[model samples]
Target: MGRKWHGQFEGEVVTDHAEYPLRGRLPGCRIKHRMKRNWLKMYDKAGWILRVETVINDPEEFRVRRRVRRRGRRRTEWVPLRKSVAYLFRYRDVSLQSNAQYLNALAQVEDPTAGLRGLDTITTRKRSTKALNPVARPDCQLFTALMSGEYAVHGFANRDLRSKLAATVVRLNDDPRRQSAQVSRLLHRLHVYGLVAKIPRSRRWRVTAFGQRIMSTSVKLRQWQFPANWPSCMTPSKLVRKNRRPNEGRSYAPFSGGPSTSPLRLVTPAIACATNSKLL
Candidate 1:
């Protein structure tokens, strides 16, 4: 939950409907939040056991000082956690603290089923009679933006939310009026969908209890669950380690069927990368 791994995790949350075995499915769910390469993960077992763990991929983040004897005198020096097993107690303490903090955060959240209907409240068309489905497109993106950590505790106003969506979901060049109108429509749908509720006589809105669970679950599903079974895709990188004078002449020939000493071309970093079959 810290900023270090805030958006670095790459894993999936298995929904109840997801099938595992070829013949029969298991009762409880196996949820995993993992970071690629580093393999940091938090998972549950037997419906009651919960464990929070992470690799010390970067020892500096958890490094501490320890006392050591030098020349018959005791002094403290920075002890890199990854470099020695002597600091295993400190490591265990930090891990337990993380687990406790995670549990405390979960305990503070009200149960989704506390005196309310199930997630069907969102799937149903009763509230959202219009075709404005938040689970899709611009609407979905807006929902994700609202679910940002800062908004979790204190909700948001349309004006405050606009800043988050602009230049990401909404075009930065768009006029202010257009941006406001778009956000207004999206927030309206959220209210109708029972995912958010407006404060009395105020423009502020906060996520409903049911919405907390649904949106959180949906985000996890979209990020990891839906693509869990898909074949892994490789990223193509082009490495150009050339250094040339800016005024030097260059050649262009791929399409003309002949090499020609062309003038040095001043191009954007993007175009330069594109010319070399790379993406900057």
Candidate 2:
């Protein structure tokens, strides 16, 4: 008997001797009849007997298999390639380093506070003034004008109120434009704080009720008093004369001598000569 391997199948076996050909070698003679009988008995006992057919000349057979491959490992380096490239490009030449140092020195020599003084100091002062009391600050003159009856009808138009205030202050002093800018800045602050509202369809603005209250408080806090040197347009001649009759013996007119009697004279000859000359 040849060595039997696991899962190997023999040729088909026939149970009926009449179905087999009476040749020298039968087609199913190679299979072990005893093993086939035992397998059929086991199948009957397990109730798994199945009718099966084998195709001897079938086509379309294929085989499939799976395989895994290992990959090569990589090396580790302490220094990075990108850092080396950056260093090379940055320090490529001596001139570049010299120029960089020169630029740094120039930056140091330049007026560092040139731009910052106006921006930082002036801004801080303005903010401090506004915080102390918004309406009291000259910067808030636009809001002040709005609070006052000066621009009540005009409203807060595009810098119109500021221009008017500038003109007024200039008429009073000098360099009104600078004062006007300060007023505009204050008005912007008031608008940001929601104390003022812009009128729709126009550049004019107005103070809210809260603004009015703040203005009233500011007026009280500042205790504004009329300047001693304030000028007035009234003249002595235009001064109103009181319509009062002299008291009993008091005289109404300036004291002068008593009224004098004088004869009325007329130049008739000269008048007649002038009339004759005009006619001629």
Candidate 3:
């Protein structure tokens, strides 16, 4: 009997023998051998003729072929499956908590907001009942200029404010002399919005605490883009009671009366007559 050889290819076992393929015959081809020890015959499912035949050769020297169907026609071709370099170097999968811990540790290596300051106190105007949030476009621009310290000092004129914001924003016209009208409109809107106040009869304006909050927070948001993962050092300032002192410019007195011990009373407005109206 010829020497029998056994080996594996891509986890599949194969067998071969010596002197398997005769001259002018392919490897693994079935043929009547002189020793008759290297022939294998497999009958077809219909059992009419032999379909699969193998001749013993080198087990590791086998070729693989696949049947591919295209346009309703079938064809046989050789296709080899092999491992890639990236697959050999890939790392094992990690757990969710492990990944999160790694990211948390990586974040602690540096602080992005170490020197940044928190937002200032935000309060609505004393006599104004409108919500102070969502500042308007012109108001936001004017407030940013006012809070930049230079314009905030000694209060700034419409021209000086325009000069400060000229290169940064495009709201002002190209002609410096013609910017007064636009600047005055923005100042009037800011006053109406209650974000800043004018000193009795002066051309200058001062930003309120509410305006500081709105402008600074808006600028910070625009600059930082409100990243998905907020840094650890971006903590806000600690809050204190504005009414702690009795002489502070508090709008209303704190409710010292205990929780209501009786049912609440409701007030209703009386309808007015059209004939008694002052502006009909």
Candidate 4:
């Protein structure tokens, strides 16, 4: 019964048996217009139970007898009628721990290589080959785009990523090529590898959290960089604009309220330390 109502989430009708189609397993029954009121009262009293059967008065279309008589004859016509029927519902309370196992299984299915550890030194997955590897130039680009936070809400489309790549990353020849087709194929490959998922009923793709984490780690490794201790070097309020070049003697005050220096060059700790030493 719980599975039968699951289709309601997907815009399917409750009466339709698409999700749990009726077959030879259960005996066929027609919807009845009348039900015992005593049974409904009993079910209502025990409504606090997890699983219970209740009688509901639902409207249905059917033929009904009409009082409009001609030549001493009664007539029957098709009309809508509110009828009572029996319905059984089963409920279960699901918690985060209960759903965690399913989520883990789904993640493994999405990206087979995501949970793997120590591919270079300690451990390696058996029955895996280089040919089955998914990380490539295009895949890297897609991952980077997903991590950029530009498409955080609506995801991204093929044309959107293609244009972005053409401007900054992928170089196109003077003659031009089938960029549209190439981008489509690239997106399909990413979907197959479970890096990006296509939104249902839409031509957009969103990166999974696992994909984002792996891409971020890969970028850090490639640049030989590590995560910073501080949140950011400067805030918006601290930003300053220089109208003139450094040689022109344009200066800005430091955040430490020390002597001003040229805004064009970066202020390193060593420079600040030397300045303080001289002042001392």
Among the numbered candidates, top lDDT falls to: 1
Q: Please name the candidate that would achieve the greatest TM-score relative to the true structure.
A: 1
The segments of candidate 1 whose C-alpha lies over 4 angstroms from its true place after superposition are 1-120, 126-128, 131-137, 170-173, 231-280
List the candidates' TM-scores in order.
0.37, 0.27, 0.32, 0.33
lDDT of 3 by residue, 74-101 (tens): 9996543223333221111112223344
lDDT of 1 by residue, 196-260 (tens): 89988878888887777777776766667657844444222112224445433333334334456
What is the Cα root-mean-square deviation between model 1 and the actual structure?
17.4
lDDT of 2: 0.42
Candidate 2 local lDDT, 1-280, one digit each (tens) = 0112347657454443222332563322111122232211111112233222222121111111223233664444223212233344422332244345534544688675544442342234343344423434553453455676865666666456655665343232345666566656656766655567778887678877666765654554444432323336544323332333333212222223545444323222223354435333
TM-score: which is higher, 2 or 3?
3
Per-residue lDDT of candidate 4, residues 36-86 (tens digit): 221111111122322123233332312223345558887765344334222
In terms of lDDT, the poorest run of 10 residues in model 4 is: 86-95
Pairs of residues at least 3 apart in sequence or in different chains that clash in candidate 3: 16-57, 17-56, 17-57
List per-prediction Cα lDDT, in the order shown. Answer: 0.60, 0.42, 0.49, 0.46
Winner by lDDT between candidate 4 and candidate 3: 3
Regions of candidate 4 where Cα sits further than 4 Å from its true position: 1-114, 117-139, 168-177, 226-280
What does candidate 2 score on TM?
A: 0.27
Task: In candidate 2, list every pair of residues with a backbone clash.
Answer: 156-204, 156-205
